[model samples]
Target: MKGVVIIPTYNERENIIPRSGGRRNASQYGIIDAVHKNLPQADVLIVDDASPDGTADVVKQKMKRDPKLHLIEREGKLGLGTAYIRGFGWALEHGYDYAFEMDADFSHDPADLPRFIAEIQKGADLVIGSRYMPGGGVVDWPAKRMILSHYANIYARFGTAAPIKDMTAGFKCYRTEVFKHIRMQEIETDGYGFQIEIDYRVWRAGFRVREIPIIFRDRRMGVSKLNKRIVWQALFLVPRLGLWNLWR
Candidate 1:
């Protein structure tokens, strides 16, 4: 399936548009550029959540020069999941073959996007850039952060009984068929909980889901949108989402 990478941005002024030298965390800088540079054929959709720092402007500027780049400007700061849902609708309407969920802040490696697109082309309905798997890992984080992130995915899999290793992984590719099977309006969660909910629905619909290993690098340009409350909400919501399937 032909695909476009949907990058959700919220106050990513530091990294949204390339200024002189732009933002970098070394390894992260390399991986993000890998896809933006090498995968020139794929379209990139940026959904900016009303960043005051003119993040959308930067994208607009880039859009003038790059046909692959597109932007959707929202009025206020919306959550990550909602921005992606919006982007997905845009992609589907635009006749894209595949839809992707990624972050503009660089947490999810862009270089791994090609792998997800490849999986979609190979007939997997969904592909994830996983961090907890054998070849994948989180770099530059301390033990506690690693444990929380690792076990969160573990708990998500167990709670939702999802076969995939990393249910909460944000970097994912969905075939157009998968999007067709699911109800976008039915999605209720706006934060981290949204990740598990959609994946659970995809699984319930009997779509193939696969995980690819990727070295997740830390974002050096901006503050993380991840919060303690959202973490707690995700901890509580995964099993609830499993139960939500019955209602659907």
Candidate 2:
């Protein structure tokens, strides 16, 4: 399946806007920087949330020169899941075979993208870049935040009963059919919860889900978007999906 990776950015200019790390942020995993570098064959769909720091400006300048990059500017800071949903639909309309979700702040390493694509080639409909698995880890996060994040993924997995290690993981690749049948419009989470919903749906549908180890480095620049509101949404939505799916 021909594929595209959709990254939603709010304010990542400080980290990637520079001339050096630009390559690290652009290139796909395996050898070097993934987001800003060398995936010449794949298209990058960046959905910017109107970041005040001129993140879109950087992408636009890059796009002017790099034919592989594309941008979608939203009016303001919309929810995370909606941005991805919009991107998914756009990818579908464009007839892309595989769709991906990742972060702009480097929290979800761009270098791991090629790994996601490689797993897709192996017949896995949903390939997750998991941090809890072997060789996967977090760097520079406070111990409290790390624990909170670790258990959140754990809680989402247990509550949803997804047969996976990290259900809340945003780094994922989906076959077109996964998006085609999931009834994305009905997915109500709109935030990080939306990610949980998608993971549960894909698992319930019996699609092949595989976990690939990845070292998730904390972003050296830009503010993170995760917050109590997103956490609350995930906590509230997981049980609902779990209970509802129990009867399905």
Candidate 3:
């Protein structure tokens, strides 16, 4: 099946550079190489938010050498949800069968790309790489931060009543058909809440959702983009969406 991996980036030049050692980092070059290694049939789309560090330049350089690589450079640091939404639209316009959401930070392993494809082949509409599932976990995260994430997923799941184990999972694969059922224009939540919102929408649409175990590694090169506003948005949006779903 034809598939595309959508990686969102912002000021990730340090992470996208080519390193000497054979490390599975989150750089643009490393990620493209890994995706090709595991799923050569799939294409990659880098949605860069006009990274001042010249991250888009690095992707453009690679595009010269690889025809399968695609890019969309936005004006500024638009929200993460908007980046993926734009990527999904591009994938549909280009006639892709499946669209995958991934991070450029290497936090979501590119090696797992095939696993998502395998699930897609099994009639799954949405396949989530879940850290909360059995045999799934995180690496090198602080206790306080981990607790926050763990409870956040729990809270979101409870509020939304979604069957997904990882309601806030960003690493996911969605069949193009699922997108046809979802209102992409209505997805306004950004950051972690964006993940939850999509998951809930998929379930509400009656799409088959599946979660596979994956080890989520922390970013090695650049700083995290998480902020207080993102956190607060998630905290309030979950219950609001839950109530909205109920009323509808």
Candidate 4:
């Protein structure tokens, strides 16, 4: 089945390009290269939000060389949720059978991509790269951050009652058909909440959901996009969605 990997980026030029001798040095092969190495048949789509660091320029350069590389440059910094929303629409218009959500940085390992495709081929509609599952964990995070992340997932799980371990995970794949069933226009939250809402809707819609083990690493380069606003949105939105689901 044909698939597209959608990466939403803001100020991720360093991670998209190969650089020398720095803590922020991207992967030796760069994210696009690593993805191509793992899934040569899959196409890569970059949904850049007009980063000041010339991130889109690097993508354009790569696009010139590789026809499989595609880009959607937003006028400004739109939220990650909208970027993926736009990407999902584009994938549907272009006739891709499956779509993937991945980070621009190396936080989500490209090597695990094959496993996701494997699960999808086996008839799973949504495959999550879970960090809370057995054999899956985080690397290079502070104790406080890790604790918060862990409990946040628990809280989200309790709130949404999704049958998966990692509700806030950004690393996942979806059958393009799932989006056709979900009410795309009604999704309001962005950031972490976006992941939860989509997963909850997919499960509620009776799609088969599966989780695979993945060791998530913090970004090796560029600034983190996470903020207090995004976290707070998730905190409040989960219970609301859960309560709303009870009536349905």
Best by TM-score: 4
lDDT tens digits, residues 1-248, model 2?
Answer: 57787888788775545545335423323211265453445688889889998988988877777776778899999888889999999898998898888877667766567888888888999998888888888888889878888888888877888878877678888887788878788886866688788888888878899999988777756676778888888889878877976777
Candidate 4 residue runs with Cα over 4 Å from true position? 21-26
- The C-alpha lDDT values of all candidates are 0.77, 0.78, 0.89, 0.92
What is candidate 3's lDDT per residue for 1-248, written digit by digit as tens? 78999999997776666556776444545777777777899999999999988999999998999999999999999999999999988988889999999988888888888999999999999999999989999998888879999999999988988888888889999998888889989999998989999899899989999999999988867788889998898999988988987898
- Model 2 root-mean-square deviation: 3.2
lDDT pick, better of 2 and 3: 3
> Which regions of candidate 2 deviate over 4 angstroms?
19-33, 36-38
Ranking by lDDT: 4, 3, 2, 1
lDDT score of residue 212 within candidate 2: 95
Candidate 4 lDDT over 135-248, as tens digits, reads: 999999888879988998999898888788999999999999998999988887898989998999899999999999999998979988889999899999988978987898
lDDT for 56 (candidate 3): 98
Give the clashing pairs for model 3: 15-27, 16-27, 16-28
Better of 2 and 3 by TM-score: 3
lDDT of 2 at 91: 92
RMSD of each: 2.7, 3.2, 2.1, 2.0
Off by over 4 Å in 1: 18-34, 244-248
lDDT of 4: 0.92
Top lDDT model: 4
For candidate 1, write residues 127-233 as lDDT tens digits: 88888789988888768878887888888887777887877778888887788889978886766678888888898899998889878777757776778877877
